[model samples]
Target: MLNVDGKVVVLTGASSGIGEATAKVLANNGAKVVLAARREERLRDLKSNIDKQGGTAVFKVTDVTSHEEVDELASFANDTFGQIDVLINNAGIMPLSFLHEKKIAEWDQMIDVNMKGVLYGIGAVLPYMRIRKQGHIINVSSVTGHIVNKSWAVYSGTKFAVRAITEALRQEEAKNNIRTTIISPGAVVTELANIITNKEIKKGIEESMKISLPAEAIAHSILYAISQPDNTAVNEIIVRPTNQEI
Candidate 1:
């Protein structure tokens, strides 16, 4: 919590799962957290909960698919906190199926939210962070980003893209005092499985999730990454359940 305290963090997909858990953890440690997602009611409720725990938190209803909304999210955080110390591009979706099944809408949704969303977040905060010469960008990837499963082709592709993007940002911005972190979590308990329409794939995922880690597990990894000294960039973390094989 050393480097994490008193930082202003803008987190997306903050309504549930990893994002929500991370927001609570960071705020509890004295980070002024801006929770962003499309669900206003959820954001409001989360903000209230954080407030109850004596954590600094704010809510912004945002759709990661829209560039304008992400920019506004950044500005809102800046106007409120006076400085943006971190951006967590944690918004994403995983709708898995065979390529032949042609879940075009789901595929498009993944690319829009998983890939473009991360890009927009980077763009939103770069100018300000560069000016201050200090910031951190933590991107939530997946274990699938490092390995492709039978039905996880497209989802894996997007996650892989996240790793690539984070690496590029690190190479380009480390000189400007911008730290980049890629968090690749494996089979965390989340609602991500609810969106998988393929019956076969869903069943398999559910079985595998019997050994899943809690969302808080991933959040702790984030805490470790951000709590590192400012000169140390915790570049990538791949967290899988101890029993997880693939």
Candidate 2:
């Protein structure tokens, strides 16, 4: 076993979806998880659920768009768990729209949460990791990043930035014994689809959801990467349901 016992993990977007599942998975595997999200009730529910299953967890109300909020989340994790061994920058928003429609508000939200949010997460946790000389960061990208789609222009751009940032961080942090991994998932069934504003796009996404996957599959991939030996940095993982053509 790679032995993640008692490792403190700082997780953003922990109220639902992949972040929520990963929190549970890592805690069940003996990691002390600090959860962050904008939804207080959801975070509390997730913490309660984890506790019911005998896993350790704490939640901080956070909006990843704010640097101070992200910094506070990291500080809270350190205060609660003594040190952070991992930071999962899993917070994101996907409000898909065509360029002609010009959903500027949606575009701005995606840019803030998807791109700058990840950057804020790095800013918050990098200092602590550098000080400790050990850490792991997992950035959640999307298959849209690797392969562009019609309405996903902005979302794909953000994820591509995530992948590029993750790779750069991995190479730069290697000397410090810090590892970075980027996870790109395709069409997994989650609340992400609900964010699409275009009616036609939303309809297409709902249909695509039929061929999507369970969140646990992504959690399993995350566990697989986290459980690898320290010397082995599994830098990127892309997963999609076998039935998902895109």
Candidate 3:
């Protein structure tokens, strides 16, 4: 490991699933974790647990869809921790529905939460990282980002945009000493599937969940990426359960 001890890490979507898992993993490894999410109660609970484990942590209630709130989150982390070593743009939503279903509202929600949210997080942290000339940005994508499936068009589009954005960021910030990583996971057991409004799609996802990897699996991958030496940037990691074919 590259000694992440005392490193300041700011993680979005810290209330549940992969975000919650990553917070615990990083905090236990000695990182000062700043947790951000819309749910204040959940964030507080998570922070308390981390403290109980002798890991340092703090929480900020934030809605990633709002650029202002996201900016405040970054500022909060910096003000509280003194510096931010990493920013994890892990907040997202998955509401799969066929295009013909005309779930325009759901489509908009996904775009806002999944695509725009990632962009806002980057915008919030890039300036601070650029000034420091040392930081890492991790964005969560999905296997659907690589290959679209039925009723997953909009969801996949958002993830694909995430991949594109992360790669471009990696290229642009490399000389500035800012590392970028994209984590693409396949069917991890999380609350993401609950957002699917389409009956058929929800059923399909439930069936897939039976063999899904736990959120901790993705958290381990994140730890691995951030643990690398400054000169080595793990650009992309695609993780899935052994039983998963996609």
Candidate 4:
């Protein structure tokens, strides 16, 4: 219905949550989606479901933190689909804890997966896009990037980095007909809260889950952005439930 049929889309973080949902939505709308994530089983399951629905999809086991893996996925998409029109950098991790607690490993993992992972995705696809003079890059940030909270120092920092990078990428690629879009979701129910080791923060998020929107809501927003005409780029979208305030 959105005129996105036959487009090749390479989506990271496609094993579950928003990534899985977006893969389904885009495929149903006529995109050939290449799913990538660390979980091979999950990817296979999603691929099967998409195929059963008469949608085109494939899976590549990818760890977005690994540049080699990300590059391989891009190559696979191009080889399989002939071209990749969109790269959705949706792989990220959010493990929140007080700075005072000094959970250095969790902090590092968030930085690697949330910030560097996005960079790897871009690095993998930008060259092809530049050569073709056309492509779309979608980065998933969070409202916390704009409004930080106590236990979210490192996680928020990574998201802020994503926002900044997406904006810069947009400005640099405009001349090449390459579009960059950022989706800053406030609180859609997902496994993101499972990483929060901080008891208080975990409790708060669990209680708030009652009002959080489903991952499908964010998936639809992604489809909306991707459906826009090539010349009309929707730069950024911020989605949140009506009940969520800060």
Query: Top model by lDDT, which number?
Result: 1
Which run of 10 residues does model 3 get worst, by summed lDDT?
1-10
Q: C-alpha displacement of 135 in model 3, angstroms? A: 0.5
List, in order, the clash count of every candidate structure. 0, 0, 0, 0
| lDDT for predicted candidate 2 compared with the true structure | 0.89
lDDT of 2 at 150: 93
Q: Which stretches of candidate 3 lie over 4 Å from their true place?
A: none
Please, what is the whole-model Cα lDDT of each candidate in the order they appear?
0.94, 0.89, 0.93, 0.92
Q: Which whole-number lDDT from 0 to 100 does residue 47 have in model 4? A: 97
Worst 10 residues of 1 by lDDT: 1-10
* RMSD over all Cα atoms, model 4: 0.8
Instruction: Estimate candidate 4's alpha-carbon lDDT, on a 0 to 1 scale.
Output: 0.92
The digit string of per-residue lDDT tens for model 2 on 125-217 reads 999999989889999999988999899899999999999999999889999899888999997878998878789999999988888888878
Clashes of 2: 0
Better of 1 and 2 by lDDT: 1
Q: How does residue 51 of candidate 2 score in lDDT?
A: 98
Return whichever of 3 and 4 wins on lDDT: 3
The alpha-carbon lDDT assigned to residue 46 of candidate 2 equals 95
lDDT of 1 by residue, 170-228 (tens): 99998999999999999899989999999999999999889999999998999899899
Per-prediction TM-score to the true structure, in the order listed = 0.99, 0.98, 0.98, 0.98
